[model samples]
Target: MTPSAIPGPIDPPARLLMGPGPISAYPSVLRAMSAPLVGQYDPYMTQLMGETQELYRGVWATSNDATLLVDGTSRAGIEAAIVSLVRPGDRVLVPVFGRFGHLLAEIAERAMAEVHTIETAWGQVFAPSAIEEAIVRVKPTLLALVQGDTSTTMNQPLDEIGAICERHGVLFYSDATASLGGNDFEADAWGLDAATAGLQKCLGGPSGSSPITLSERAVEVIRSRGRIEAGIREDGDASAADFVRSNYFDLGMILDYWGPRRLNHHTEATSMLYAARECARVLLLEGRDAVIERHRVSGAAMLAGVEGLGLTVFGDVAHKMNNVVAVEIPAGVPGDAARAALLEDFGIEIGTSFGPLHGRVWRIGTMGYNAREDAVLTTLAALEQVLRRFGASVPAGGGVDAAADVYRGAA
Candidate 1:
């Protein structure tokens, strides 16, 4: 194929991503990615890496010394945490409530752990007692789960679950990929031994560079069995016979790269590092608590707006995530057709639900850079038009008016 046969230089469409994550990144975050590059171990590059690590410490609400960024998306952070800490034949327990919970179990299985799971219905979260019961029954070495699952738009409560894990002598880990920045996550206070998250969701960046943290205990588990990567292995130290399977996803090696020793791992993704740094910087500048509250209000507005359109909401509302809402697609409306019209005509994109809830609910997100009054109102207005056009009887201006009332009340 000739070069001209390929597409021209990428020109993506302008979109308001009122969906579940990879939402529009903050303009500044995108600009940060375009900054000039530096050599991997250049003093300034390492300085930026260290600064980025410290920034993530604040974002994760942890003081753990092993906090750092994983090179791939949020899933890489999760895989690293599991494969590094969960040895083959170790018993792992996962409390399942949504698709991401199942995802954790799948990853744990691939890591060769003996995985056990107790499930709750979709659109709901497991109670702390339920999780404790599973722990007692499974007596697992680690507990893997997700904090916010975009699939169900549910936020599992972790505070009591963490305490329960401690009582049962199990390591606690959660993928906070969809919840970290715009929702309340207290890694240290809530007793999370390991937490991994991505830049795409509430962090207001693209889907690369996973920020992760490990408690002293979680770090100890990894260090006890971990071998230095072959690339940086020295003559004196011996490599482990059962080292982690994937070198690139090895948190132990990645930590050495991010840690004070500055051991060479892979050449870091420089552009992603800059973007991750900027995402954390922007959120911290706004204040983490402030960001959570902003999402709460914005998400509530979106929820109320959807309700005003005479829509029923999916899920257990009390435990629903603050960054996304699941609206039940109206009975007569063509769900995907309405979605396509919203995208094509209004340049707005709302997500479809996953798994059991697929085609039953439309997931709308007011997350990351799009978590705002204007975004909520704009999406509601566009959604109302699409709903009406598709033969659903939506009240004219109902969505926007309800959202405006929410903003007024909030102010």
Candidate 2:
């Protein structure tokens, strides 16, 4: 390849991301990413890091001092928390309801923990009694769960599960990547030992950084397994015999880097840090409850719109998340083709489901910056066109009108 063949600076076409995340980032978040770079230890950079931790405390509704940003995607946070908390051969219980639930079980297996799973149907969430019964049988050292799984648009109830784990003396962790910021999550009140989330969902930013918080108990476990790397080791520093296996995901070392110790780990991903900081700042400015309410309204509108178009909604509608809804594909409509047509002709994007729901349902999202009146109405209107074009019967102006009624009711 010739040097001249190099592509021009990235100039991608714009489209509304109405699928399950990596959704449209807030405009302010994009502007934050472009801020001039600063040294990792620059006073301003350190200040921003500390401030981000505090802001996330409000976001998580927790007083945990161990809260901070992980230098990778949302999955990175999940791995960091699990691997650091669960030692080799430790038992871990996971309750699977959808794709992400399986992801938690898989990560636990990779950590070499003896993983146990109890699953309900794809569209169903477990009752508190069911989780408690599993806890009694497994007696696991950790209970790993996903608060929201986009695959089925289902939100597992975490509020009661935490107390169940506490009674059984098990560490409770939740992957809130698809739920936090857009839903009600009380890390402290829910008795979560650890929780992690990504920015691309309801946080209104790109996917590079993850926000994570750890309870004091969770922090104690991670620190007990601490191992400072050789070159960075100082006179009195110590390492545990069963230290966390993955250096990159060792929460203890990461903590030293974020803590007042000012220790060096990896050179910070400065721009992503800026983006993370701004996402929290913006959410706090808008008021956390207010942002969640916006998501509730948008999700309800999307659900009504699809139903109004004569589409069937999937899952236990009573327990669906406030940000995404799964609409069953009509018998005659080609799901992928309709989605592609919507992308090409309307310049919008929605998602197809995975696993059992694959080819059976389309997952539509109203989240982050795209959770608005105009975005909901436009997507429904465009989708009506796409469905009709694909030879599916849809009510004329039905989707828009139903969605509008929802907004009016919300107002």
Candidate 3:
């Protein structure tokens, strides 16, 4: 256990990540993280930060001035949005379709809000009518939902839900961590008060930064709860018991840090800032619509290829995200063992299921840099061998051949 006895420098095996998330980052993102760091308040750093904010505005399809990155994972962004907007005793309605929906409710509860949730079957999503009924019944101040839940690979329909919230005079927020970039999301056109996403999914970056957008109404609510810290406040500054519960997650303070005022909150995460900036730059440079179409084609190919291998896909095909898919584990193939074989034998990594689907399905992802024709075909080929080795009957080259047909059709 001595230092000298340890292996030389850090090194990792090359892996083709076809999992639900934390996929292999784009080469440009990795390189961006290694760029030289500068002082937090350096002019160049501030300029870069401003540019990142603008770039994310385009990515989120919003005109909100509050669009920026949270210095943590996607969950941090979720917490920041919920805790800042919902005060203790405030009523919040959450429609639970999968694990992440439960997460939104939990974070709201932790912030001392009266959280109410309506549930649907895991493989399905809530109808617009169901959500409207909940909003009317709960009379909540906020309607929090997940746009995409990787656990079930279901994308909740937000297009109509936003209008439903608007009719009821409620704030609408969504966690698009797994759907953004690969899917079609319109923050402004859809009437979203707040939305958050992470870069690891379809943005082809690591998990440190979370991009968030807040409509003007959402900002006004957050502003009412703002309380400047003692260290930064001067005489005549105001404080109250109703200040945001967690200073670190207070969107008001974070906004001040990112805004033109340039107030010091926390030292900005410099390296992650570079990576996030590059991720948005790459997406915009390629054209957002073109990137989404690429994901659609790749996701379709993966779906067809799995069916070609005689495996059933979970969830309603119409509701699935264009990034990840869940396929039922063959009747007798040891699920975990099969996944391990894929990793060790072929240097590929697919995902395992959670909750109700555990041990029943394997989650395969075609997202970000991995959402390509070659990645889809390679994963299908490797997965076929693993299934056959595990005693599941798989036609030779069936998966890859079927996936190739999808690519050809797209061409």
Candidate 4:
């Protein structure tokens, strides 16, 4: 473990990322991250932050002024929104459909909010009426949920859920970390109070930074707790809170860093901001619709391929996420062994399920830059070989042929 004992530099072997997140970064994004670094307060760096915000606003489909990047990963953005908005004793209602929903509940608990949950079976989404019933019963101050749960590869229906929150006067927040860039999301139209996402999964970038947007109401709630310094106060000025708890995750100060005032918070993560910017740039240049369409087609191909491999898909087929698929493990097949073989022999990575789905399903991702014909074909072909080796009765060339038909239809 000593320095001299350390081995020489090693290059990474190329592999297709077909897991939940931190998916393969695009070549352009990697190059952007490697560009020369600058001081935190450099004018060019500030401009980069501004442009990054603008880019995310378009991706989020919102015009909120409070859009900015959280320095850490996607979870940082989740904590920033929840801790900033939910005061102690505030009622926060979370809907538990998958593991990520439980994550929201856990974070809200850490923030000292009184948490309530509307529970649903994994791989299933709550109906609008079900959510409305819970909201009316609990009268929660805040409602937090995930747009897509990568653990189960299911996208929760949002349009009606947003409406229910609005009707009940509850603030709506969503974690779109798994769905953004690959699926359709409309923050403003969907009436989201706050939405946060990461660049790694579908945005074709690394996982160091998070993109977040706050609606007007979300801004107002955070502003109520804004801090004011003695030196900065004037005779007629309004005083603010003495200390905003959790300084590092404070969105108010983050807003200041992103706003016209341009105050310092943490030194902006230069490489991560550059990567996030490039991710957005790639999506924008491709046109948002085109990017979404690409995910749709690729996901369809993946679905057809998996089915053609003589495996059954889990969950309601219509409710699946656009970038990830869940397939049931065939009877008597060693799921773990198949996945390991896919990685070791074929240089492809797929995900295993969690919670109730443990040992029951294999999750495969078709996301970001990896959502292409070649990636899909490679994964399908590798999976067929592995399954056949494991004694599954997969027909020869069936998976590849089915996927080819899907691609042909798209063309």
RMSD of each: 1.9, 1.8, 1.6, 2.4
lDDT of 3 by residue, 63-122 (tens): 899999899999999999999999888999999989899999999999999999999998
Per-candidate TM equals 0.97, 0.97, 0.97, 0.96
Return the TM-score for candidate 3, rounded to 2 decimals. Answer: 0.97
Which lDDT values do the candidates have, in the order given? Answer: 0.90, 0.94, 0.93, 0.90
lDDT of 4 by residue, 130-197 (tens): 88888899999999989999988889989877788888899999999999999999999999999999
Question: Sorted by lDDT, highest first, which candidate order results?
Answer: 2, 3, 1, 4
| Backbone collisions counted per model | 0, 0, 0, 0
Model 1: residue 387 alpha-carbon error in angstroms: 0.7
Candidate 2 similarity to native, TM-score: 0.97
Off by over 4 Å in 2: 1-3, 226-228, 231-241
What shift in Å separates residue 238 of candidate 4 from its native position after superposition? 13
Q: Mind giving the per-residue lDDT tens digits that candidate 2 earns over 347-397?
A: 999999899999999999999999999999999999999998889988999
List clashing residue pairs in candidate 4. none
Worst 10 residues of 3 by lDDT: 232-241
lDDT computed for candidate 3: 0.93
